[model samples]
Target: MILRSPYPDVEIPEVPLPEFLFGAGFGDRGDAAAFIDGATGSSVTFDELTGMVTRIAAALHERGLRRGDVVALFAPNSPAWVAVFQGVLRANGIVTSANSLYSPAELAHQLTDSGATMLVTVSPFLDRATAAAAQAGLPDDAVVTLDPVDGRTSLVDLLGSSATPPELEVGPGDTAVLPYSSGTTGLAKGVVLTHRNLVANLLQFTPLGTTDETTRILAVLPFFHIYGMTVMMNHGLHRRATVVTMPRFDMAEFLRVVAEYRLNRLYIAPPVAVALAKHPLVDEHDLSCVDVIFSGAAPLDAELGHAVARRLGCVVLQGYGMTELSPVSHSMDERHPDDDLNGVGYAIPNVESKLVDPETGREVGPGERGELWVRGPNVMSGYLNNPSATAATLDADGFLHTGDVATVDERGFFRIVDRVKELIKYKGYQVPPAELEAVLLTHPGIADAAVIGVSDAEGEEVPKAFVVVQEGVTLTADDVMAFVAERLAPYKKVRVVEFLDAIPKSASGKILRKDLRARENA
Candidate 1:
């Protein structure tokens, strides 16, 4: 029983991503602000942004980057970062974004798996990027820094004299961005999003009343993540809105930017919502200018949502999607401000969804909890270089199994009930259990390990490890956590560790994560 979007479908363009974004139809909002650097108060207007994109595109093309070539971007949110992303697309090269906080090993895996020949990063990350590049077998010249440095080539040097964008045979089907995701299980694999998938999602989300020339969006979310890539960076620029970019989320700085810029919209994850609800710092600043807040990437508590809404006197809503869905399928329409805050809201335009019993593989009726399966123009083409995983995820009928357990109400609103996958969401970032277990096994003291998410006091899911230490080895929980912290991102570090005699496993040697979760609850 498939449920369709309540809204009417809109036309999605079939042009290449660059053409669709910077084409002639958009009127003279050219002088309007496109992106603002929150820290330095620097601004880039729409007209200037287009020129920078074209120049960078021309430079990349002149430097021998061609269509289908992969260029990796490893940086935090900034106006320059936006230019680099669009520039890569305009050059007909696929952009593979990496988390700026990634360790060398983690970054190397993505670079090798994505087949990225060139790496672009900022000065602060140069050491790690260089190490990762060497590990991935990339040449020294392939690592380009954002700023000019003594030994490395800077992006500025590549911005040659010409502002002409590269001419290439790009089609709607051509892959544009390769953001990595763990999907339902395993280590992260590159999600192959084509030009049409992203453009379609932009059009699908436009009717939600978040985009316009007059809009000022606070971009605290990382652009490397799909949720930020689509909703904040692409959508904001497409609408010619001013985006205030924050390199990192500092509660006081976030508030200061909002007050200073009079930012009217906020694109954020759930942990920020908790701060808005409980943190006294929220009261110290004037947030009356904010008219709406859209929270995504993880589930936001209904009561907490309401509390923040009341505190800020703004509309607070939640949305749901995965990287495979161009990161947005259902979002609360700002036009219908009275909709229930509990559900993630109705499907966006042109999206079709159904709830199915995971065991039976049969569609379930409305209000029944089942794994969500979505089919839409915004669904990704496949996982890069992993056809078997892609086949397992995308069915012959075209629905992409989300691995998220949800229920659709009679009115077609969807609420996530549970997750069927082992991917843990720590403040909306994917932390694969298998990846952590692999890291744990590398520790000499650890004989075996299984990882599962346990809800912290703040209601956020955090990775907790149950370890089987080698005999005669005295391994403290701090020692286990420190080992992971040295090799993984701060968010991916295990927060809790429990020493165990043995990790429960199936006869096939698969870690029984469900058993560990049950033990945590017990």
Candidate 2:
């Protein structure tokens, strides 16, 4: 009952990540612009990028870092960030990327869990990085800045005098990047992606676009996110396209950069698409150069997608994937654009998908809603350091349970209906309910708490807390929200609070989230 990809199978190369990315056919594009700093108007050519990668790799090797060591990157999007990421790979080390907006506690958990030996970040985040490093039991020198500071070791200091890259044996099956994701339940875990997984995804995504040396791509999405890491940064470099990087997203600045650079391709989330559709600032700028916009990370409403496409007079498409699937399994083909705009489109090359009944464990046919099970070279190796979690996610038959409910049309297109997991999607970023509940329980006045996502006025899902207060203590919603706001990122903050007499739980003491969701909707 497994449904295969409509496209022909693609050849997945067995070489290491660095070799597959920078080897044989990538030469002669030396002078082409690889990445551009959107703010500073600075540019790095393909030849210079390769040389920087090698120098950084040599520096890392000289600093006593050996193959298989984990290096953490905690910086915003920039051309330099790209070099640092690729440099880690070229050094034969694993790269663990952290969200630039993370709080110190959040960062510390990732650092400790990933066992990162060194942390690389910018000066703006030095205070938080230092705090997190100390909390994680890393040395003072373990945290370094990307740029040269008065007293800190900059990335330049680690660069070796020689331009030759270090030579090391890296297998296709070796773990390359460790990106954190909350699979179906609980806190985030490190997703172990191998060299083969990344290379295969890159090859699989090639036919979906017409990117070339002349293509100018706007890369405003955070590189720490898997969608940006693979589709925008890695794919842009592999295609030798001109990529414009933004440190953060500002509506005015985003439009200015697009008009200034004449960027043609945009990779963004659903919320940004809403801005393009309804914001008046969009009409003030000249966005005629944009040819395509691809939305991912969350489901984009069909009406909003069409509105943006109509306003821009361009094609708008959606794709679907999780961090465990190298971030993309199905995307709309550039060659045959869908007019309906509801489906995320057909599976890309080399990936197969099937819809199954979650309760029955039996495959369902087209036009029936069921949990999606995908199998492909793009599937991750497993969750790092959590064999039980890995066993629960990746099956013996090699399919990764996505925990998302979807339906397939007769023509092979797929559309997401709902999520079966408790992870809330706040404008595409994951907000785990269990993590928020754990934080709420720490408050002295709170006896019990349960969190669930409720739709806001903007159609985006936000975290709402239902709390049970201590018998004689009084607490306000602001106090409850301020407590969480101090420890969590802005996106993970509790947006709404409701006090209850008691929390509904099972006999085993597990909070029934489905009951809370139903109450919220009712």
Candidate 3:
């Protein structure tokens, strides 16, 4: 029982991302501010942005970057990041964006695995970026910072190049960006997204009528994440909306930027909804400019969604996606203000979805819980260099098995109930239990470790570690937590630690996560 989107299918253009974005029908928007720096109030007009992209592309080309060559972008959300991103595309090169919070080791893993030829980062992150570059065998000259610094190649230097922009060497089917994801299990793998995958997604949501030239979007979420990359950055550009970039989330700064910029459209994760609903500082700002707050990347509590709507006098909505789906498969449109906020609204145009029982491999009808399988132009090509992982997720039928258990109504609205995947969502970031468990095993005092998602006091999912200390070794819960924290990103830190004599396992040696979950519930 395959469920098709309720909306009419949108026609996707067979153009490269750069051509789709910067090529045609943008003359009128040339004078409009394309992106603004939230803190500095600095901006670049559409014309200026295109010019920078041209210059950056020319510089990268002159510096020997070629088609299919990968460049790793390791930075936070900023207007400059957007330029460099599109710049790489314009240069006919691939980009693999790394999480801003990644430790040197984590960043190096991505750099080495992605086969990135060059690394782009900011001055503040030079320590980790340089260390990661060295570990990945990247030369010092390969490190290019967004901001100018002494003895470092900077974006300003790139923009100074007088060479002509290279011809479009990539087409719709060519790989454009490689964003890492811990799909169903195991370590992070690069999800191959093509130019068409991006362009199709941009067009697929056109019926939503959410943002346009009149919209002012607050981009507080990290642009490296797919939610921010597609929904906020590219979508905003496609619709000619002014996007304001925030380097990082600071409560006061976020509010000030929203109010100052008179931003009306906001795309956020569930955790931000918690702040918007209960944080007293939210009352301090005149957020009347905000008309919609759309949450994605994780589930939003219905009560929390309503609370935020009540507090902000705005419509609250939720969407669903995975990196393997080019990030968005279903989303609540602004037109459907009456739709239930809990269910991720109708499947976006051009998407066909199915709910299949994992055990039986049988398709489930409406109202039955099953693993979601989606097929669309926006679906990823596959995982980079891992055909087995790709085959396990995307079947021969073209359906990408999402591993998330969901149920659909007769009307085609889907609600996520549970997940078959071992991946944990910690504050909307992917915290793979396998990754954390592997890190924990490196601790000298730990003999064995198992990590699982547990609800914190705030009802947020956090990674909880159950450790079995080696004989004659002394270890505290704090010690276990600290060991994992030092090796991983901040969001991947083990919040709760419990010492266990032995981790329950099946005869096949698989960790009995269900038993650990039952223990947590008990």
TM of each candidate vs. truth: 0.82, 0.82, 0.83
Pitting candidate 2 against candidate 3, the one with the higher TM-score is: 3
- Model 2 lDDT tens row, 382-488: 99899998998899989999888889988889987666676788988878775687577667577677889999999899999999886688999999999999999
lDDT by residue (tens digit), candidate 3, 1-522: 889999999999899999999888477889999999998989999999999999999999999999999999999888999999999999999999998878899899999999999999998999999999999999999999999999988999999999998998999999999999832244779999999999999898878756889999989887887878998999999999999999887789999999989999998866566567666799899999999998887666676778789999999888888788878899887886888876888899999999999879999999887899999999999999999988998999999998888889988989876567767887788676756775675565666678889998999999999998877889888888877778888998999999899887522133667788889879
For model 1, how does the per-residue alpha-carbon lDDT over 410-436 read when each residue is reduced to its tens digit?
Answer: 989888766677678899887867567
Candidate 2 has which clashing residue pairs, if any?
none
Assess candidate 1 and give its TM-score to the true structure: 0.82
Instruction: Identify the superior model by lDDT, candidate 1 or candidate 2.
Output: 1
**Overall local distance difference test of candidate 3:** 0.87
Displacement of the residue 411 alpha carbon in candidate 3, Å: 0.6
